[model samples]
Target: MGGTLRVNSLAIQDRRGWQKPYELTGRLVGIIGPIDRGKSSMVDCIDFVLGRSVRFKGAVDDQLVAVKAGMQIGDEEVFLHRSRRRLGVVRVEDLAGDEIATVPINASGDQQELSDWLLARLGLDDAFASVRLPHDRRLSFASDLLPYLHVRQEDIDRFVIRPQTSADDAARLAVAKLLLELINPASERLGARIHDLNNEIRNKQRKADQVRDFLNASPETNSGTLDADLDRLRDDETQAAQRLKSLRDRARAATQFAEQRQQQVDRARQRLATAEDGVDWALRRHREKATALAQIDASLAELGEVAAASSEDRERLALLYDACPACETDLSSRAVPTGRCSLCTETLPGAAQHKEKQQLQRARERLVPEVAELEQNVTRARHAADLAREQLALARRAVDEDTADAVTPYVDAITAAATELEALRSEITTLERLKEPHRRLSERQEEINRLSEELDQAREQQVRVGAELNEPDDVLQRLNNLFGRVVSEFRLPWATGRARLDRDTLLPMVDDQDFDQRGGGSRTAVSVAYSLTLMMYALEDPTRFQLPQMLILDSPQKNLGRNDHDQDLATRIYRWIIDYFEVRREALGGRYETFQLVIVDNNIPTAVRSGFDTLIQFKDPHGFIRDLDHPHGEPAGYEQLALDDELDHDGL
Candidate 1:
């Protein structure tokens, strides 16, 4: 008991309900119960608590909360508690109930804490993280190794540890690698190194290609003819410089002539200004004089008409009688006075009237002379204005003609020289830009030279590593032989004509027949033989094996005990495994530590049950879930309650 490393017990607890704690224990524990009685549930709970990678497909009660398992790895006893409420979290504790660690089962690095702790307890080194052989992902998790410890009912017919239905082909290859690495840890290290080297080689090759592409696309520059090209460019530059200087000298001379023409234009503009002012003044004077002359002539004509009417009025007055027509007064002797008309009887001063007529005639005569004099002055002013205008026009025309003759040649020379210089400058800029690609080509060539050297060294290293990557064939052969011998010892229906395990498939082969061709019973027998063979091989060298020396198989009796013959064969198979363990112990002179085997089935043969160290049986409604009022292994007290109720009815 002290030497053996095995599970001591598995306990299920429901703190929220009336269900009591149900526990199963011992090395060869047989949980015998009928179908749908929580038999498979008990197996699933144990697997869950142990962190096995099997899907739970068993009965679950709403009241169930968590499951706990206790196992002894070597000399250390540990407890694992897994809560159904928190499916992936596992809490580890010592036998004394001290918390050792809490692990979350996830696909992250922190989740590996549980796996690392478990491997330490099982006396194995920590598996490298994310290390894989070719064509496989990293398969170093603690759960990844659980397949070897437990024989899952769902994958019982499968050849490898996990079923092809649940696991892919890559997982099977990983299992083979895991086995080989267990025998030779160097293979794992070598594989990881080889993977790194391959990546390095690819990365270097890509860089080299990039450099080569850059070199290939480089623009060609004729360095051998560079001197001749430069000499030609220098000659072009010299000719351009000389032409530019000559044009500049001519432009300076023409600029001086244009300045002289501008001076002439300025003088002409001044003269035009003076002439325009003079013409404006003269025209205004002429208009004022003509208006005066017109007024004078009108006054002279009016004076002449007034003189004639006055003469006629005087003659009539001399011939008329000296009486007023209206009064008929006898005033013949009263003469018509000078200031008064004779017919009106009002007298005026004759001398005064005559003087007024004389004054009128004199004023008319003086205006005519003044008008003539002003008209003569206006004519002279007009003649002088016309002469000034003619001189201004001549000056403006002379300025325009001089500007056209002198400035136009200088403007044309400057434009032609500037256009030629701009074109030459553009050519020089294009030549400068073309040289940049030549510099880039040299840089790429240097990079390619350096990378080529490194590539050669990496290739040599990769080749050496590849040579060491020989397949682990010898150890696989030994494993196959052991499995074949175990299959033969069981003597199942399919175990005939030199039975053996196929190295590639990891399944039993009877002569040339594969495990898939066998009947269900034959396969079951062969599967059990293989499971036993693995445990035996691990126990032979526990230090080198990564699998724990414990196996939990659920419901092996389904195919094993379908009929009388199968039942007999199953009985023999059980005895054979037990005897195998006993022989190993005996061979070691009681020094060998036997491993654990937990069998869960509905039918446990009476003889086989007797040899088991622990036996738990399910009957009636008394299962892992116990009734609150009526516990297991005890009859319900309903009869007593009914009797008391009857008495109360009769008033007892």
Candidate 2:
């Protein structure tokens, strides 16, 4: 059983920035007013605020920018607000009007959406339903239940249980099953598991098919030959490995021998470089000695020329000093001392000159022997250079001979071995590449087998859980009787007092005739009866059902005429509602205590007006938007309606 959801009030903000509040706290709340008075619009506000998808258009809807509802679920009091500008989010507030959390309108991930939040409060969070098939299950959202809870005027005469097209037919049935307690969490979980297993099996089978197709596309390989091919390839691989190893062994021995010969060649090259360097050094030393000897000879010749010049100069100076040239005085008879200068009458420089000549003579004597010794050394150095050159030539020849002997013979053998090994390895690699598709095919087949086993187990579990579904036939029988009784009261023209709910369609059938075969008014009567019957059934055992104790019907008297019979039927419908609420209240507690009903219509019959707990009425030019000057057309400054609403409710 879920907690009771009592809608306290609905507030609509219009383009004029005015919030029109309607109190819906009464058990039997009726919004009765003339046509175009926004009765349906008010119901839509409740729907929109409760997280139902509604396309807002037309005059009054265009003027509306936001809708808010204050509600009490169990012991919690909260306000839910939805803005037209922001379509996907609903703002939830606490009793103190403080913002608590913003929840998404639809289920997104693990986050609690508006539907889940409300369902949690109602103790129906675990309720689930299937859309098209029993296995295709999903959590039941508020929208799934809204079609049953709130019946629009247009749908009242057109549908028996809202056909919901092909997509949502299963959801419609699942909701009925849930309300009737024919399905529970355990059965739903098993069904969902079966659905998941089926999906996994399909996926695995698809992969297996793809792998099989790939294997078939290749003419040389298939699943049957995969093992044989692998065996042959492995044997060939082993032979190739052995051959490669033998080739490597032979190449290794040859490489060792070559390395030894290379070492000899390296030593010979080193010897050749040393001999060349020695030759160069010897030649350079010979040239240096020859140059030094030449320089010594040149110095000796210069010393001799200087000594002869000094002697000639001394003789000429002595003759010139015989007469003084400054005054033409001949001073040749003036006897100058041997160590005096004749011109200045000072000591003569002859002693210094003679000592220098003696030193020069001594140097020439020493240089003469050294020159002879240097000539001998030059000859020896040339001979040594010649010997080094000959040794260098021989060493180079030896190196060339060693290189030719070491590498040329092995080149062809090593290259042939390497080429053969590469070809063998390449063939092995190609064989391995050809084996890949077979491996994947095997893996995919294994997966398909595993998934098939799991799917079988899941199906067995589904059957076991499905067997536990309680009294589906008994529930349908009870519902059929309840539906017949409610339809009988409506006095529908097609009623034969033997009406039964169609088991498959879950719709009312009169005298074995389909619901769609009836007239408009009769259809409307059956639709209203069907909705009322569901509510009555839920009320019969509140603890066993998760349906909220609320029902909102818009214009149940939609197709009825102004005739006496038609009016009488309309009055009976209202009276039935009023009487039902009265019975429940008296049986339970006070009015507006247990179940809540809100009816939107053009007018509530005068006879049953007093039976309602709350009746809201609007006159001409007045509607849900009480202060709207223009109800059917765009008002002034309508473009700013959303902006004005945002500015006014920004704090909220």
Candidate 3:
């Protein structure tokens, strides 16, 4: 709501070559193309450049390599590029083509660098949503909103945000709540705090339980006997310490050598303890490095497997010649060309395969250096750990030799007193060790209480903040009104005036049935209506909603039949979108310049073609990539002429 994200242009580069730049800056645009003409691929470039993981179809995946988009985010203009040659990175550049930043793409995480940059520009950098639980939340990402903003053809006949699990559904709903202003930032922050408190309290409780179980299992010590045992050991230690002082005085007069040896033994024991700690620390570091190396190796293996599988699939598709495997179309009239695809009649050049191999090589090159570095670290850590263990052994031997030398000189004289004193001191040390568990248990319980109180306070504050926000009834009512209007205009058989929005699921409901329970055509109508309603509601009060003023619907007429009634319904749907655009354009006057809509379908009715500001149509044998025939890498400009003619026909 703070600003808008507009795609000004997009350029796609495949194995063949770069396509003509698509001018996408318009209030409304329609991408019309027959099947396999790369209509969806063109739209997917926008999504992929904007930070979405899109897996292109069989041939498209094999041929496509890179995508770049020029975007205007409010007052800022930037160019974004994503390439198959570079793994897990996106290149951001300024208008002058100077590098702005290289953002890393985390394979699995809500806090992505590119998503953060995009969300920050839209004033939603701090947005969050609850996932499995109310307190368990994750940051809202661009991918989370892409499903609603760009409705794919495959998803148009399902719910607006088709979730795979209950947790996914909850997360999507939480995002909706944030956009609708039903959940405020204060509440979200408090929820995070509460979640942290919960984890801390549980950890403390677990430690306390372990300590309690230890005390209970011990035969000589327990929580009830710790204080008594400590007091008894203290009395015995005092007596033994006095006797040892007397014995030391007598032994000092006999010889100073024994006293010096005893001091050496004490120093050696301290060194031994220090060496033991060093060994532990070095070994822990070694284990950590080894684990990291293992993870990197696993990643490299997975990347290799995926690349091999994709290449194999491409090869298999290339070898199919009996018939058009995809559509089973007869190829009897087509001559068997030496180096061309039977389906699309496009040239199959060896340079394209070489380019794919180069991409894989580049991706591997990026990770190989890191793997080598990790291997070196692991080897160095292991060597350090071994050296530390050797030092520990030397320290242990020194302690034993010094102890034996110190005791042999005055063995008979002080044996009875020294032995008795040693026994008392060892018992005291053992009792002290047993008493520490009680102290730790008490501390852990106290921490648990403190965290519990903080958790309660955090929950209370969250509740108070949530109560202050307005109910979403008004928003739901408005959505239902818009949805009903769209459904009626589409003339759905079950389009009763009583169509309402589900309070829990936020889905359209007719005759007490949810959108998912309806037929394919009805489901498509409901899904489209839901998206349009949300966009319209955001446009009405942009300040209250966080939704961007853009919508891209892919093949809204996908499942609709070819009958006259279905044809009229599809036409009416287009008309409704046109009318809504015109009304909003007049209402906002200048502010509506940011609003953009893109519809991708196989065909568009001639009557509504004039309503769009831009039209892109692709004929057979030509698609988003048009340089498939050039073995010497010459640009094919025929597709550009076709696009220009289509635009001229639309009077744009």
Best of the candidates, TM-score: 2
Per-residue C-alpha lDDT of model 3 across residues 1-652, encoded as one tens digit per residue = 6358778888888776777789988989999988877789888888888778888874567788899899887578999889978847789999898999888765455545777777777777676423334454455455576776899888888667765467777777777877888776787678668877898888879878887887878667676676787788788778877877777775556555455555655666665566566556666665655554454445445445444654545432234354677888765334323334545666544433333333334544555666566556656655655665666566656556655665566667567777877887787787778777777778879879988988988988888998876578877877788777776777777566667788887877776787778899878877888888888878877877778777899988878888988888889999989987788798776657677889999998888999999998887656777745532345656643455777889998
**Candidate 2 least-lDDT 10 residues:** 314-323
Query: Which pairs of residues collide in model 1?
Result: 338-350, 339-348, 339-349, 340-347, 340-348
After superposition, which runs of candidate 3 have C-alpha atoms over 4 Å from their true positions?
A: 107-112, 128-142, 198-445, 467-470, 627-652
1-652, model 1: which lDDT tens digit per residue?
A: 1124467777776645434445555456788876767677777776676665445443355445787777776567888888877777788899888998787765374456555556555544434343454455445434466666666666666554655543445555555455434323444455555556566656756765665455446443453343355567767777777787787786567556556556656766676676667666666766765664455455445434544665535322233434566788854333332334445645433333444344434544655666676567657666765776676577667666765666677677667767777777676666656655545655655665565555566566655654554344655576677777777666676446476666666656666777677777676666776777767666775433445667877766546656877777778777776677667776873324447788877777787677677888887655665543333224645543455777889998
Per-residue lDDT of 612 in model 2: 82
After best superposition, candidate 3 residue 447: deviation in angstroms?
A: 3.5
Best by lDDT: 3
Number of the candidate with higher lDDT, 1 or 3: 3
Error of 2 at 573 (Å): 2.1
Residues 5-24 of candidate 2: C-alpha lDDT, one tens digit per residue: 77888887777774757788
TM-scores, all candidates, are 0.55, 0.61, 0.59
- Full ranking by lDDT: 3, 2, 1
Better of 2 and 3 by lDDT: 3
| Model 2 segments more than 4 A misplaced | 15-20, 53-59, 62-66, 82-89, 102-111, 128-142, 160-163, 184-186, 206-439, 588-592, 627-652
> Which pairs of residues collide in model 3?
none
Q: With candidate 2 superimposed using the best TM-score fit, by how many Å does residue 271's alpha carbon deviate from the native? A: 30
